[model samples]
Target: MNDLTLSSLTGRTVLVTGATSGIGYETARLLAERGATVLLHGRTDGEARAAADRMIATAGVNGERLCTYGADFALLDEVHALAARVNANHPRLDVLVNNAGTAAPERHTLTADGNEIAFQVNFLAHYLLTHLLEAALTSDPGGRVVNVSSSMHRTGAIQWNDPQRARRYSRVAAYAQSQLALTVFAADPRVTAVSVHPGVCDTAMLPLYAHEGCAPAEGAAHLVRLCDPATEIVNGAYYDRDQRVEPAPRATDERTVKRLNKLADAAVGVGS
Candidate 1:
């Protein structure tokens, strides 16, 4: 909410995943209103298009400033396709917001790609998408990535040997682990990136945080601030809402960051 005026984002292009609902939707709307060309992503093409249409109709966002893209993050193939489409369409993406996520189901589930459902959807998919879009993301000096991580990462520990948790599984632990890995990924040397906890907001994931929460727009304000070029940032930094703060100790460990990259690359078939 730091006076992010309309002219602040002119000529910038941002891609926000999970943009069909909650904080993601509000973030996309705010960016588009501020003159950024926003790409809205959802689980499917229909859902993404509908979100863009809704923004145009209700928020008065210019249709020309919004575009729609979709891919089911549960599948690695779809994530690759999503990245390819974005790279082909926008050669110089200014910001990539890794916001798509899902709560772990009570009954443990596994994706066809052989990863825990929450792990694949919440972390691995974005990991792959971000790596694949390297050419476009690095096309400009100002390009960067913003990971919408969570404070819950503090309670999580990576199950290095059995990341899928095939032998033992708890919904809460699974979700927390995914968020922790995402936070650690910010330290990756491949791209200039940072992670943030956008505050507990009244969104689909609110139940995981608290009984009551602030509005989605309030959470989105923090994200939009990080995306602004005027706001200086350090690679691998973590933020709590609008304040730059330390993340979980493990998240900033260089060794952990390298290990997570290796694990994620293998899990997502990055080099294969």
Candidate 2:
């Protein structure tokens, strides 16, 4: 084992949603280089395939270890379909990286299922997917779930009564709330749910959202570290550069977290 390089992620299988671009792609590439069997998940087949190819190309793989699963995170039906596919194919998915995310520049955009796009894509989608794959995630004692969040989660409040941003709208706040929800969602004790702020990378997402930071690789490195078994105890926390950081006051509120859990369960029609 000592002879193996860092790219020797042998025997490990990782499923990274939103692996097409940004921190998602960088994390996939890093895992691939380490020899992990990475399953790429994206909203579209074309994008997902492209990202899988890119990871293979970038990681200098000989055969296809990185795969793709096409699922639109913004839709509950798609999330269900994805769960079925993943369960059937992946016996024990080592890591569930909820890295795929979106932010709406417009006010209160809804998905095909009529939920807020940001809420659905950034938070609800994972809620549904993870619930469906709970068995797979917890099957292994060391299984992990890493959610890519943003520092913007600090500025927003959990609008339990109006989480969908139905009556009002600010693109930034909406996005921030979604991210914040992700952070709070990590409260689950069974399957380790982790949140990360990738520290400003120059990805297309940054241009659209105008986020400030270094590069995708730099931000992704922090996320990648969470994949290590040593970091397993760092669950249920927010991180930057692999360092545990304080979440917003709202995230730390036990009552608020319990309420959000109940609300999220109701939204997903599961554990309430």
Candidate 3:
């Protein structure tokens, strides 16, 4: 044990993906500073290892709680493996955070999994990860899945006709669609889920932003609260900063959420 004790999270465990930087990083750091054993995710070994080191070096926790996993969210197989690794060690997960995301630059880039890059990384990856971990989450008193999303979700909707973006993909459009789906996923009650906008934090992704203002730490505060069990009623909502905002009409559909979850399962090969 160390000098700092986040006794508030004395026995809880949280997994944060894309945690090497920005909002995800800040959230993981705060959780570690307290008492929650946080699992941080990065897409590369170097990034993952570096993030874990930084969390430890910076947080100064009692036990070694912050560790990193290198899984590219753009690939389904990798997500499955990432889930397996987490499940192998933790019997039940108190918190599962889907915080990794990216925006493509003006071009259509396909990932190794043969799907649009933005779609796969932002939505599909989180979808598979959450489904695979549902058993772990639901097995608990009532686990939470904090799907890191953005206010941009209001700018787009799910293409019930073709979610894969088979016709044409724009960077903004693709990313927005994924986030919208994330918002929908978070609303499901089988396992508590909520999508959060990290309040325009000063993370690396800011370069991708058309507008600016919010800092990452400020945005992460809401995410931290969402992780707390006391805030159970906030489930299935999209958090813009600290307050919950309504998702688009498409995001509020049970059939759409279920359909998207099914597509995600087929892509990653799993079930609800």
Ranking by TM-score: 1, 2, 3
TM-score of each: 0.98, 0.92, 0.90
> Where is model 3 poorest over a 10-residue stretch in terms of lDDT?
1-10
lDDT score at residue 239, model 3, on the 0-100 scale: 71
Candidate 2, residue 117: Cα displacement in angstroms equals 0.7
- Displacement of residue 269 (Cα, Å) in model 3 is 2.7
Q: Name the candidate, 1 or 2, with the larger lDDT value.
A: 1
lDDT of 1: 0.93
Question: What is the C-alpha RMSD, rounded to one decimal, of candidate 3?
Answer: 3.3
Report the C-alpha displacement of residue 188, candidate 3, in angstroms.
3.0
In candidate 1, how many Å is residue 246 off?
A: 0.8
TM-score, candidate 3, is 0.90
| Candidate lDDT (C-alpha), each | 0.93, 0.79, 0.78
- What value of lDDT does candidate 3 attain over all alpha carbons? 0.78
Model 1 segments more than 4 A misplaced? none
**Top-TM-score candidate index:** 1
What range of 10 consecutive residues in model 2 has the weakest lDDT sum?
1-10
Q: What is the C-alpha RMSD of each candidate to the true structure, in Å?
A: 1.2, 2.7, 3.3
Q: List model 1 lDDT by residue over 55-156, tens digit each.
A: 999999999999999899999999989999999999889999999999999988999999999999999999999988888885456689999999999999
